[model samples]
Target chain A: MITLSNLISRIPGGIAQGIIWGIMALGIYITFRVLKESDLTVDGSFATGGAAAVMMITSGISPWIAVICSFLIGILVGCVTGLIHTKMKIPAILSGILVQFGLYSVNLHIMGMVANVSCNPSKNNVFITMRSIPKAILVGIIFAAVLIAIMYWYFGTEQGCAIRATGNNERMAKAQGINVNNMKVIGFALGNGLVALAGALMAQYQGFSDVNMGRGAIVIGLAAIIIGEVLSEIIFPKGCQFFTRLIFVIIGGIVYYLIMIVVLWLRVDSNDLKLATAVIVMLSLAIPNLKKGE
Target chain B: MLRIENIKKTFNPRTINEKIALNGVDLVLNDGEFVTVIGSNGAGKSTLLNAIAGVWLVDEGKIFIDDVDVTKLPEDKRAKYIGRVFQDPMMGTAADMWIEENLALAHRRGLKRSLRQGISNSERETFKLLLKEFDLGLEDRLSTKVGLLSGGQRQALTLIMATLQRPKLLLLDEHTAALDPKTAAKVLDVTEKIVRKSQLTTFMVTHNMKDAIIHGDRLLMLNNGKIILDIKGEEKKKLTVESLLEKFEQASGEEFSNDAAILG
Candidate 1:
């Protein structure tokens, strides 16, 4: 179990998992970090992406292409939330909830005739059973790498800095000639795109896309980001240095999955996993506030 | 270059806690004019600048920048025309970003922001030259985050940023009030240099009556809701604190009781 080859084999898998969660953490980072906007759209948009991917793939599109479509659709869902917040003057939190609820029905309807689109391993189109694991890992790495590069470059730009300034102080952003609304819209769109990419990748990795796949995903993603921030604060007391926060996001995801694995290892009773995950997320949320107050 | 005619604003309208912040306040600024405003704590000094900057929709009157109607323009929309520095240093620039990045945002005024990296080599050179003129040693620290800067340095940087785009009207609302006397004087000098060099139309509000009278070519005193005294030209040249105080009492018929305003 502890052999060199075995450890090497696990590296690819661990990296893939970390990157998969990185996508979701990235989505959370945009709303939480850049715009300082709390958004629940990730919960629904993630499922919306998975559902859309499954429906399209089953309807004869390649699974690979389906993933791209899901990402684009995720951006659209983010736009809807932005529209509601900007045009209706609805609070960001409420707008996210409204979108999440609406997407519940929308996600189910995307399944065509079934309640869920089960990926039959026997009837594989794009990937074989033996190659599926490596393929998923490869895809996850590529997606995470490309998206991470894009984010790194984007946030370094003037507009990207404006988005960050808006998060820091909207009034100051306006005083500097930055259109805060446009920055928020861009952040929203980018956040959802990453979430949908996560959803699409998840569908391919698990060989299924359920209507409720994205339930509580927002909290989980947030949990990863929070854990990462906590870890990072300890390592670098001066806060994020360049892409260190993104690294924490990846680390947070691995910590998240490892905790789940430990729970399973300890023989947690059936249906208790959800409760445990919720407790973990709640702790992550509360811990940062407590630290800040201290 | 900047004019306000009968501008009015009331906070919490039609309510028990209602307040008439600005009551038909009117003022004018000529091209390359430097004017300072002094008022009591709640004497509509800030409200006047806020109105000019389109911070809130006015209840009445009009604001014009070189004869363009801008009373209804939102705060962000007017950023191209007005550059404002606030009392709080943190309120002017993004502390999380590097000084150069914040400068880039200011330098890119009226330019479209895309996903590509901004701050070209030429712009960086320009920023270095500009910051060097401030003599704050900020030229070598372009990558340094603004949060690391002292309060004085931050305010100075904000001053440079406000004047970067050569705005039609530069609004300095107590830009140096938070600084110590020494740092405040230095910032005031930098401010004067920028305004003089840019030939910018400037409206600066200050609580220190002496600063108002000393730096700017003209000084206006505000009381309840209007300019109580406007002193400039030869009369301004010969004017002193005692004479200005005498004029305030003559115009308002009320003794200026603000000790901080007089003492400063």
Candidate 2:
């Protein structure tokens, strides 16, 4: 029932949103793939970033400064989770949940006890807005490119290698004199910082920050990562380099949005989108295990 | 140079599962002395090694490396002077990492990891040479993931990694016990070569009685959470599997009954 023009019109907006989610997915990849942890902090930290950025911008702060502040706040949030998991000896998943539960109040306070904050692009010079979809897409692509570059460079360094090794094998890392707990803390901080950065940008792009914006952010991030990994395996059968894997993660996000657009065109109820996403992610996650059976 | 004075460790104390892992253990090792440790199941052999490696704080006692008291230090802090290889071949190396990357990690052991590039071009050359010495065709596969390696190759790589930074003390917790006989012998040969080459003060725990008698300058037998026998110098050189069994009976006042220890 959807015309070709309708589908074409949705591409730019979908791409823009996909790019933002791709950045969020990169954060998840750092924790899920690099650090080998299932961190639930992103769900809360994403909203925290949106709250921080919207509040700071509404108070006459530069958008760039607001983004940085959001990232720093996210790092603190991640540190709290890491400390709970490491010092308190709680399991990583439980620590993440505890921090996420606590962050709801913190996010509400940051938004001045409100569930939502709006940034009117007409009244203020916002960095990116849905009004100009093409510009938003360009800005999103640039951010993704810059972030992937920084991550690639950082992971090639010795401290970065230590983090990777700690994620791969904690016992071996400790034996090699690498402080595994410190590495975990650092990794969590960095991952959440990036997620917060994405949330900040996303608030500007969408013209509003809502506490519920991050409710299912973790699932979307995982979906992006899984899509990226599967796509990379199919496209690059020779295996990918570190940087290439990251590039594919962003590409995966874009593809995920495209798929969603197609599903929407088929007249699926918008309210059931989350259910569809969950099923997609579940199938993607089980693909490797299914292959092993063969 | 390592010393353990009156160390004690008890697991699940005051519970039905209470077990004494180490009971007032006392030991001293001169610099560069290779000591082989042997014991039956539940005899505190691995416990002694774990205590020395600072896996956890001893319930009571003092530990020192080169006269530097390290009793209160955590495992990572003590790692500066200690190198260890575990019984599981998969425990000593990160399976997802490339062989060179794993080596690079070991190369920086005890050194602060900074923003410097990992595995420089010159360092890669050194690693290639080192891998070539193993002659297992690993030099050609420096970028290969360690998970792809066989158990013996992993054990050999672990041995190399343990000695890369030349720790003050090396602990091998049944490092070769997981491999087949042929692979075990090859790995042991490499272990001896590296140990002698670096002159590392080493503590090796093994179930094989013959291996205990054949290697190391000194031998120790643990029984019931205590060292029941300690032998060294000319006396250790003359020991055989039968004599070690006899010595275990004499020291512990019980027959050597562990089948794995006897037959391995």
| The best candidate in terms of TM-score | 2
lDDT of 1 by residue, B1-264 (tens): 888899878899999999888887777889999988987778888888888888888999999999999998988888988888999988998888888888888887656777668677888899999999889989999989898999899999999988888899999999898999999999999998999988888889998988888878888888876777888887887877888888989998988877888998
Interface RMSD of each: 1.4, 0.7
Q: Which candidate is the best by DockQ?
A: 2
Candidate 2 residue lDDT tens string, A1-294? 678889888988999999999999998899999999989999999999989998888888999899889999889988988888888999998999888888899999989899999988787567888999989999899989999999999998999999999999999999999999999999999999999999999999999899878888889999989999888999999898999999988988888888889789878897899999999899988888998996
lDDT by residue (B1-264, candidate 2, tens digit) is: 999999999999999999999998999999999999999898999999998888889999999999999999888888899889999999999999999999999999988999999789998999999989878789989999999999999999998998888899999999989999999999999989999988999999999988988999999999989999999999999999888888888888898768987888
After superposition, the stretches of candidate 1 with alpha carbons farther than 4 Å from their true spots are: A1-15, A124-131, A230-241, A278-294
Residue A268 shift from truth in candidate 1, angstroms = 2.3
lDDT of each: 0.83, 0.91
The candidates' DockQ values read 0.67, 0.87
Evaluate residue A273 in candidate 2 and report its C-alpha lDDT on the 0 to 100 scale: 95
lDDT: worst 10-residue window of model 2 chain A: A120-129
The RMSD of every model to the true structure, in order and in angstroms, is 2.8, 1.3
